[model samples]
Target chain A: MRYSGFRVIAEALTGHKGWKPVWRDPAPQAEYDYIIVGGGGHGLATAYYLAKEFKQARIAVLEKGYLGGGNVGRNTTIIRSNYLLEGNEPFYEFSLKLWEGLEQDFNYNAMVSQRGIINLIHTDAQRDAFTRRGNGMILNGADAEMLNRDQVRALYPFLNFDNARFPIKGALMQRRGGTVRHDAVAWGYARGADMRGVDLIQNCEVTGMRIENGRIRGVETSRGFIGAKKVGVAVAGSSSKVMAHAGMRLPIESHVLQAFVSEGLKPFINGVMTFGAGHFYVSQSDKGGLVFGGDIDGYNSYAQRGNLPVIEDVAEGGMALMPAIGRARLLRTWGGIMDMSMDGSPIIDKTHVEGLYFNGGWCYGGFKATPASGWCFAHLLAKDEPHKTATAYRFDRFLKGLMIDEKGQGAQPNLH
Target chain B: MIINHPILGPRDAQEFVYLGDANLMGRPDGMTAGIEAFHDYLYNRDNPAGAHRELWYHEQGDRSWLVVTRNTVTHEILKVEMARDVARAGGRSK
Candidate 1:
């Protein structure tokens, strides 16, 4: 049912029993025109756009578990389009635009807060780099502003301004970058896709792929064999394992990245802030808790839990950034597997197998790229061509030495 | 996590640096095998969810490269061997 302020008042007056389930839990169909594996944010969004935008029919999304149980729910919820590389900047900017209009379009309250994001600048070299980055962002039609040390102090006076080393000199601010209610994104897209005749099949694990001469067939799942004319795999960290079923190896590794939240307190942080010299980035949630995270657990592992050293490192970075938050008690910490690519950028392209597409290698930044990743993957699946903004996330780029290494770290997934 | 070093009894995981999949040690001859072998060596991985043989450098300790056979799911270390020995066994020479 469509929800609105008027509906709320009517339901309140009439015993409030008129609410309906957000999406249908449909049984697996015998066949489908298109099937998207893994019902995370990217998969759900792909199904949503395929039905709504592309007007495709006979679509199905098969999830191993319930929707939103993956990285969609296991993130710091920060969103931004502030990037430097040509292959990445435009795609993320498109995602930011989608986040801007997402709630209204999907008819859900996703809490898309454009409260701004600031990347602290420490050294003069960082200042020069951020200046170039700001110009690049502006060139891509994304908002960017360079804030001096005084300006940054005016915004967040509680920050450690004058440290012996790594003092905050300035900041690169993006007024449109902020956080979203991540779970609502999954629910919104699920509801939108289900409303558009897409079957969202949960508890259905794809066991194997039935490839006849590699020209596309269907998938064998825990439930049964489900036939599909086309198949798209958007499994984030599980991308390598799932694609391995089709005898294709991806340039991706699964690494655990942990996030933490502090106990609820009065809102003090104005926007998302990142430590210039370290890996810590934090933002105050709508529930008044400080949600923060740092670097990934620099190793290859599928375990959804991290070790202690990274935690200590992140805590040290947080302490170095802001001493006031030291007193706040940490409420909880969780980890999500990251699809860290060799080049640190994502890959959203069709594989060597015809009719089988892949979209993964998002590393730790998959949460912010949800909309554009889905939209681009949907465009590729529907039109059999790469989206205009995402033309560079191909598999052959690594072989051609045209990798989109944003950090300039070569071939090291852990470093990326 | 503790890595039982072959020389040193036990070392904290923080004292080492992780370079992914031990397959990286099997560096293909680029001039002889061409781009396909190089691409496979540089990119693809056997990222199993169970026991994984990976390369770790004792950067903060002995500066020795070691191979650790550990379970990815449980983070349990099964075996540790000097990477030089493993590489030598695989027929690599200076």
Candidate 2:
């Protein structure tokens, strides 16, 4: 079943009984050539690309729970390449390009909206900083526009432009950056991989790794022992605990990041907007619910929930940005675990164990970097070398004092 | 989250900044601890799902650091004490 306008019409005429399940729920195989753990966006995307691009077979993705049950489904869904660092800009730009053609490639309706994103500028120094960032984006072959106060006001007149403390001065806009249907990404990649003979084993928790003489043999799971020639661990927040099975401690800490949505209203917000002076970003969904998020809970915990103070803080930021949001009734809030690294950048490299690979420490960038992270991780696994765009994401970078500290916040996972 | 401050009574947790693992306050003598110990001190921690002792700075309050013993699973604060008192009780001087 190829999905298209013709197929939709045919299915409609036939009373819509011809549709099949998106992906199969296959049982675990006795062994596989490659086993990727953590069936979130990155793991599924890696399996899809490994089968599609690298032409690998006998691939299986092991998930502890159902598909799309992780950060892939718990994000704010904003996508952009407006980074300021060389180590990050090109890679994210590549991901943005992948998001542009994702629906066509996966044969799914992902709703990749390029409604643009604006980082509001509140001060003179912020304008200068955004100028440098915009220039960096352009240099990295990504689109960026520095908008003046009038231009920003024209785009989002609801913003509090006359605040005495944090008045809106201008903004840095990227017309190509926007949101995507987050879970659809997971489903599409899972369906594509499954179609290509890749096994997706859900509810199979890996308990331990069977290492022989510093090399990988396979994994010990709750179901049973499954042999594998190569293993890739892409567990997002569980990176530390999962890799601990192999006695490798990562320089990553897990923290809870909360997100919220408002009661559905008439469509108003046309694009994604972030408050410069604070940690608040919001965009309206197609259903008119305002999706937004702020800072993390700022603690080391693996819980998938947050407390009230952070909620109040996020609501304060929203109210400060747009007083009108105060009237909107709150719908709900959720949390995702962020694998914050020492320097706030991700690590995608092989472990000391010969046949084992590790890919995590994504922090806040995991959802946005899904496609490129998978593409680069697959390239590394297939070729045993870092992809050109991801060369800086080496595990040894911190040991060699070559950290890609994008936030310029040193060695603190929580600060990052 | 609300922390019942010892001196200030119940206060919103947002007034504080979280620093993981109250064990971070125990600084080994640099001359005695080797690189391996330092590495373990800096990078390794026991992230349990139950009660955890963490440091929180009252940034919007008295600027005192509090050692908050809370359960990660339930998001419940067990106890809160000034970190300076914890440091002194363990025998230290400035």
Candidate 3:
């Protein structure tokens, strides 16, 4: 059923009995035209666009666990398109545009809040860098503003301006960037895809892939073997293990990135703010909790947990930036397995194997790229070519020495 | 996690920069092994879930590259030693 203001009012008047499950629970089919692994935001959005835009038939999404059980629900929920590189800026800007109309497009309350985001600058060199980045963002049809120290102070007065170690100099602000309800994005896309006759099967772990003469026949799952004409894998952290079944070693590493949330308090933070000198970024949730995160645990593993050293480092950064947060007690913390690529950018290209496609290497920036990732990935799967906005996300870029090194780090997955 | 360094006292793992697989230290002589061997050394490496020996640089400490033996599954550091000593022990003193 379509949701609207009238429906909400009527449901409230009638004690809300007409509410139903967001999407249907369906069994896996024996065969499908397209099979998508991993039922997170990207997978669901890809399925939605495939059925809605491409008009594809017999689509199925298989998930090892329940939907939204991965990084889609475990992220910091911040969304922005303020990038610098030619390979990344336009694509993320497209994602931000899609995020602008996301709630209305899916008929779900994803809570796409466009309050804004500010990346704090600490030194003159950082100011120059941000100036160049701001110009790059503006050139790519995205909004950006370089704010001075006084302007930043006007926005956030509680920041530690007196800290001499990493002084709060200025910031680069993107007025259209903000946060969204991460799980709600998964739900909305799942509902939309279900309405388009896409079957979403949960608890179906893909054990192995059946390849015949370099062509994919189907996948062997926990339930049983399901045949498919084409298969696309988008499992974020499990990309390496899953792709290894096809005898392909990905240039991706799985790292655990931790996030935290403090106890509820009065509204303090008006927008998202990230520390420039350190690896801490924070925003206040609508529930009044300060949601924040820091760097990934620099190790390759599939575990969705982190140790204590990174926690101490993150706390030090937070205290160094905003000492007021020291009073708030941390309520909970969680980790998401990040598929970090070599050059700190993502890859959305076809593998050497026929009938098998891959979309991963999102690193810590996957949540913000959800909408456009699905759009471009769907375009690629339907048309058998790279999307215009995503032509730089190629698997052969590294082989050709044309790697899109966004962070300027060469072949260091964890550094990304 | 706290890693007890051989030269230094117990230090936080955050101060060290992680470089995967201590096997990276044993770079094959490119002049003799050719491109294929270099390619194998660069790309083909086992990613075990259990005990792994990796390269971690003490970037924020003594500027020493330490070969750290740690368990990938449990984040436990089994041993830590300077990479220069490990390289010399392997009879590479260029």
Candidate 4:
């Protein structure tokens, strides 16, 4: 297993002679063992695993933008296996295991900090609900802690102690959960996949998929045509459009999620904090910047610009908890599009088609699931069946009423 | 420390205004009323010398006014945050 995805990436970067450059505009292959579309986290991870597990070289990953220039780099960098579903629980645990070994395996530094992440509970009902989630985490062999107000303050000194619109009465802590360097994650996967002899074609958007007699033959890209034995749609926000090329419809809607940052300040906050009472959470980047975000803007369009309310929420949260940060200048704000599924989880299963596959609909949480999603994706792409880790993330789950409704609200997927 | 002064009796901080707590009430959770009463607190400044609080924050005008809700006993909502474009006119935060 040492000749894993990380090995592949390191091998690519430190060529046999150590003088050759790692990446180039890889020419399209006439045929390959497997072809993955969308070179984001899922795409790159898919290629890396396909090479490691299946020894499937001659594989190709088509990307519309530069590698990691998509949603994979646009997430809040949160890493947690605190899921409350059946199949998702084990696979995310697999991801947590992978995150732990990434620095050693890839010869790269992902800054995988295992700082505890606590989801604050403001309402009594919410306290009860997350209490069960805490139990679930513990039962699954993951680390967890339930904290009262004094404990929360001791853990996070910057949090507002006395008053919150929804005061933090308690929280569910997953000490194993934290964050990674988002962009570095994408780059590590790309380098690893490239080292394993996988073709990563960048700026190569798939315009159409050619199918005949119910089998995928190849794809037509904006750059040119590339023949492949199989294909996957890893575009999170644009999944609907990409899958349409294969004539498939998924129960997915695209929305925009925004994040903000304040002027650089000396490190005061240490870990990732989510104000469950309010729509605010923040993490101090290694560069001394305070990175945070508010709500999801509550509208649907490909537009990646957020309104002021979200910024106000984030800034207000900072001021309330710390108070002294009021004079800290606001530096920058940004947004990214996301593919929200009906159930607040991703759908990583094979379509009815013979040569097409999918790994889309990851909520804001996909960054944590990168390694597992790719590992399971590789399994499905190799054995020509559903993966053991991703059995619940199936297409028919919705139609058959077997949806893994994590939030307990089966009908309200888009809200989160 | 600045909030421990006394206020005139029957002279109460209105609702919606975010006051940390009364100095005497120990900056008691700002005289909390429902939304309607909060709006009414904006107009009425009863001339009760004993009741005159340090800060009369009109919270209806802006949520940024939560800054006053921290430690002060009584907060007066002065102004609300204007709509999107107005903020832009004043140069939006980056």
Reference-based TM-score, model 2: 0.95
In the range B26-70, model 3's lDDT, one tens digit per residue, is 899867987656655664445555678889898999999998888
Q: Of the candidates numbered 1 and 4, which has the greater TM-score value?
A: 1
> All models, DockQ values?
0.86, 0.44, 0.39, 0.01
lDDT of 4 by residue, A1-416 (tens): 23347666777888844334556567786777688988998888888888976687778999888899888878788888877666678778889988999877765667899887888877788888888877777677677788888888787766666664666687888888888999888888888888788889888899998898999988999877788788877888788778887777566656668887778889877778887556678888878787888766543435566557557767776676667777877788877777767667789888878879998888667889998888889888888787777888987676566777677655333465
**Residue lDDT tens for model 1, A1-416:** 78798999999999988888888888998999999999999999999999989889999999999998999999889899999999999999999999999998999999999999999999999999999999999999999999999999999998898978989999999999999999999999999999999999999999999999868789999999999999999999898889989998888889999999999989899799988478999999989999998999998888899988888899889998899988989999989999999999999999888999999999999999999999999999999999999999999999998999999999899998
For residues A145-209, write the lDDT of model 2, one tens digit per residue. Answer: 99999999899888889888888999999999999999999999999999999999999999999
**Cα misplacement distance, residue B34 of candidate 4 (Å):** 48
- Give the poorly placed runs of model 2, Cα more than 4 Å off: B2-12, B28-40, B43-45, B58-64, B78-94
Total backbone collisions for each predicted model: 0, 2, 0, 22
Worst 10 residues of 1 chain B by lDDT: B85-94
DockQ ranking from best candidate downward:
1, 2, 3, 4
Q: What lDDT is reached at residue A32 by model 3?
A: 93
TM-score of each: 0.99, 0.95, 0.93, 0.76
Ranking by TM-score: 1, 2, 3, 4
| Per-residue accuracy of model 1 over B1-94 as CA lDDT, tens digit each | 9999999989999999999899888888767988898899989887888899999999999999999999988899999999999988988872
